[model samples]
Target: MAPRDGTPDATGAHQRTPGARELNAAARVFALLADPTRLHLVWLLSRAESDVSALAETVGAARPAVSQHLAKLRLGGLVESRKEGRRVVYSLPDGHMKRLVVEAISHADHQVTGEPWHD
Candidate 1:
């Protein structure tokens, strides 16, 4: 198995190929992000941390639905949450997830607007 970019090593050996477990885990992440509501929640979180109430209002979803989506994202390891007094504030675990969400949205914007993609 070659790298995802399919670049061959000079020595002709597989370099850092993704294992089945890693692929499955990544698939789970993508699956969780497949939902529009979850993607919106993640995009919002990418901007800043917020509680469920604010997320619900911003995304025009009910609190329970937003909570459920947050729970799924938390379980999927795409987001993390911590209690702030009576509220559970949610955020992306690291900068990588934020970059991933931002890039995904940018790609979608290009696709929707028929904009030229740049390298």
Candidate 2:
């Protein structure tokens, strides 16, 4: 069983503690997520794959700005894009990433609503 504490559980035989490099990489991901525009784009991608125009319209940002954020996210491996004929659709490549984004937003909602935290 997993540990009740926040530390990684040791119950699994295949599990290994994260190294400094791994922790640094996670920190980088958090740094990228610190930006509101990028976070919004990620949140949108977590919902559905969207093209540049649609993403810009939905996020209420200019096309160039949204395209820039998407470019950065793509480079960081947080998202992936595929050519859908004339348009390129963007999506979160990993299910874990979707869950992470949703959880972060939910945490923020809890803070804003003054709700008690739960595991």
Candidate 3:
């Protein structure tokens, strides 16, 4: 088969060589943020770096629960952890994280609030 321009009709859909590391990194980041608690955690951290206790209170969850979320975030590289005395503070790994959460929430707000989307 051939395209109108005489190129192969394959449509450039051939599977390119996979970049496993890059794809895995993205997947891991998303997986870490997949939890409802983690999403809220990111929002809180976007407001400012916070410790597990504060985050647990803000999210209305147990400190252990928040710790689980933080562990995932730390492993996925979506967040960084530090020690302030005996407390562990967590923050976005970089500026892009803040922008990502803000833009995503804004997009969701606009989408849900749009007239076309309203019931």
Candidate 4:
């Protein structure tokens, strides 16, 4: 099948398209990020590893709400946590997630500020 972008697969053989399951997984991740609070949490985590309290204070959200968002993010594989003494520090698992959040915020900023899109 033709790839979604209409480009040949990396193999340079048949065009590889994303299957329904792959699309659904991506959609589910986007759905999880649809919340402003969650997106804020992700943006913060993208910067550095932080605990719940720090995340809450930084985002101006309640601790519980931030914890809940962190929980969801952790479950979705967007973030990972490790026990640091008595505190559980959360951080983005990889650079891919960080780039995704950064690009999303940049896009939003452009739209909000009426800036022209740039490559």
Candidate 5:
């Protein structure tokens, strides 16, 4: 079982080693997040679902740029969108993706702020 902190057990019974396919898939995810704007978009989505205009305003990018980033993210399976009237609201699909995005930003924060890391 996983520990309360979400780390795997020392016995290694709680996790399985990833295969090549899994590794490649994860690599693709990292590649998608490599862009700063895309990463910022994901970070915002992790907190709440929003539309193109809102995301564009918040990220301070042009609507077309944000739309392109969102399209890439959606195609990569990092996000999903649903139609609400005329607007398309986007959001992360699962808890794992949410945790991944949050943890990545947290790591960046620690690195930039020179803060100590915690388990």
Candidate 6:
């Protein structure tokens, strides 16, 4: 497919800092986190894992709504869960997911706080 800016063959993937597959995966990740609820979920997961009920309480969202969001995250491979009795504890899927979430949150903080990192 052509690039979003209409540069199908323009110096594009041929010289990008990242490969097409990597860029595509990144896009998928961002798309998943595009929703407000999803972003909040990622923000919470950035800290530690929690069950759906705890997530709902912390995010001020309903239990079903929180579960739905967790489902999406799980499908996207950005989250993983385990059963602790009846509660399903969710956490960042892996180091890659953690890096992506942290980068997004850092970018957001920079945008809002106007604080740029030299490195």
lDDT ranking, high to low: 5, 1, 4, 2, 6, 3
Measured with C-alpha atoms, the lDDT of residue 92 in candidate 1 is: 93
lDDT per residue as tens, model 6, 35-70: 988888887987899999989999999999999999
Say which candidate scores most in lDDT: 5
Q: Could you tell me the lDDT of residue 6 within candidate 1? A: 43
Candidate 3 lDDT, tens digit per residue, 19-103?
A: 7875887677677777778989998898899999989998999999889989878887888999999989999878778877886
| Residue-level lDDT tens digits of model 5 in 1-119 | 35554356885333656779889999999999999999999999999999999999999999999999999999999999999999999999987788888989999999999999999
Q: Estimate each model's TM-score.
A: 0.86, 0.86, 0.74, 0.85, 0.88, 0.76
Candidate 3 regions with alpha-carbon error over 4 angstroms = 1-20, 115-119
- Residue 117 in model 1: shift from native, Å? 0.9
State the C-alpha lDDT per candidate: 0.90, 0.88, 0.80, 0.89, 0.92, 0.83
Model 5: lDDT of residue 61: 98
Over 1-119, each residue of candidate 4 has an lDDT whose tens digit, in order, gives 54656465775433546789878987888988999999999999888889999999998989998999999989998899999899999999988788889999999999999999998
What is the RMSD, in Å, between candidate 2 and the native fold over all Cα? Answer: 3.9
| List of clashing residue pairs for candidate 1 | none
Candidate order (TM-score): 5, 2, 1, 4, 6, 3
| Model 1: per-residue Cα lDDT over 1-119, one tens digit each | 44655465775434667889879988898999999999999999999999999999999999999999999899888999999999999999987778878999999999999999997
Off by more than 4 A, model 6: 1-18
Name the runs in model 5 displaced over 4 angstroms: 1-14
RMSD of 1: 4.9
Number of clashes found in candidate 5: 0
The number of the candidate with the highest TM-score is 5
Off by over 4 Å in 1: 1-15
Evaluated against the true structure, the overall lDDT of model 6 is 0.83
